[model samples]
Target chain A: EAGVTQSPTHLIKTRGQQATLRCSPISGHTSVYWYQQALGLGLQFLLWYDEGEERNRGNFPPRFSGRQFPNYSSELNVNALELEDSALYLCASSLVYEQYFGPGTRLTVT
Target chain B: EDQVTQSPEALRLQEGESSSLNCSYTVSGLRGLFWYRQDPGKGPEFLFTLYSAGEEKEKERLKATLTKKESFLHITAPKPEDSATYLCAVQAVFHAGKSTFGDGTTLTVKP
Candidate 1:
């Protein structure tokens, strides 16, 4: 079986621009999660989507939003990006308690 | 609010030396704790999951043990390949799918 897959291995965006990242969960997995791995900041939870519904979110602002699709794939959107938003965005798909992550999309905002 | 903390931001050991990393957490209701190994510029790789205290899991030279307040990742006869950041995360029963993670412990094993 294939693992989680994410699009755009690397992304470069400017301040005030919007960026969208995508994720495709593994087969038979319905729970998808998004996380921000900022340098030195650790892996911070961003959003969780289960069965096409937004489950829970972290302490991040509203600019960070995402959605899950019918097929269990997901997308993360960042509006009015800031320089501090430059970080690796990771998408993970889970089966109950066990979770697996994708290679991550490196977002660099100038 | 739930909190997770990992000790000794960094660790360096010889190929045959053994050591342990620590992860301490405080949550209203502990549902489960997870361990992940992450290489530079890569996503975290799942290692183990411990749901209750006194539970233990092992893979190769790495062993993970859980307790009420903390978890320890013990590395024995580690190789340079074991060098990477080890992350600890916890899920609170109240928070549902949200997981609180620590900054992580970066380990470096010399040949």
Candidate 2:
């Protein structure tokens, strides 16, 4: 079975612009999670969606939001992107605790 | 809030050397502990998952063991290819098993 897949391996956007990243979970997975990893930093939780419902969010600002589709794919949206938002945005899919991650989309805000 | 901390920010060993990495955690109620290996520019690859204290899991040359407050990843006769960042994560039962990740320990094996 294919693991999680992400789109737009790299994204470039100017500050104050918007950015969107997409993810497709492995078949039979119902939970999708979004995480951000800045250079030299740990993974920070962003959002969690289960069964098409927003289940949890991290300490990130309101500008960070996402939604899961009916088929378990997910999209992460960053509004009014800031230079600090330049990082690797990773998407993961799982049934419960053990999540399988995607290659991730590297977003660079200029 | 659930938290995780990994030690030895970085480690260097000779090929065939054996060592262990540590992952300390604090959670309301641990649902599971996970281990992953990540390359410099790629997503993490799943390694193992331990559900409770005293639980152990192994894969290839890596063995992961868990206790109430921490987990340890033991690597034996590591090869250069085994060099990569090792990450530990914990899921809290109250949080419905959502994971809290550690910054990770980067390992480098010399030829």
DockQ values per model? 0.86, 0.76
Error of 2 at B78 (Å): 0.3
What lDDT does the true structure give each of the candidates?
0.95, 0.93
CAPRI grade, predicted model 1: high
Of the true interface contacts, what fraction does each candidate have? Answer: 0.80, 0.67
**Candidate 1 error regions (>4 Å):** none
**Cα lDDT tens digits for candidate 1, A1-110:** 99999999999999999999999998999999999999889989999999999989998999999999889999999999999999999999998967799999999999
Name the top DockQ candidate. 1
For candidate 2, what is the DockQ?
0.76
lDDT for each residue of candidate 1 in B5-80, tens digit (9 for 90 to 100): 9988999999999999999999998999999999999999999999999999999999999999999999999999
Second chain TM-score, each model: 0.98, 0.97
Each candidate structure's TM-score, on Cα atoms with residue i matched to residue i, is 0.98, 0.98
**Lowest-lDDT window of 10 residues in candidate 2 chain B?**
B90-99
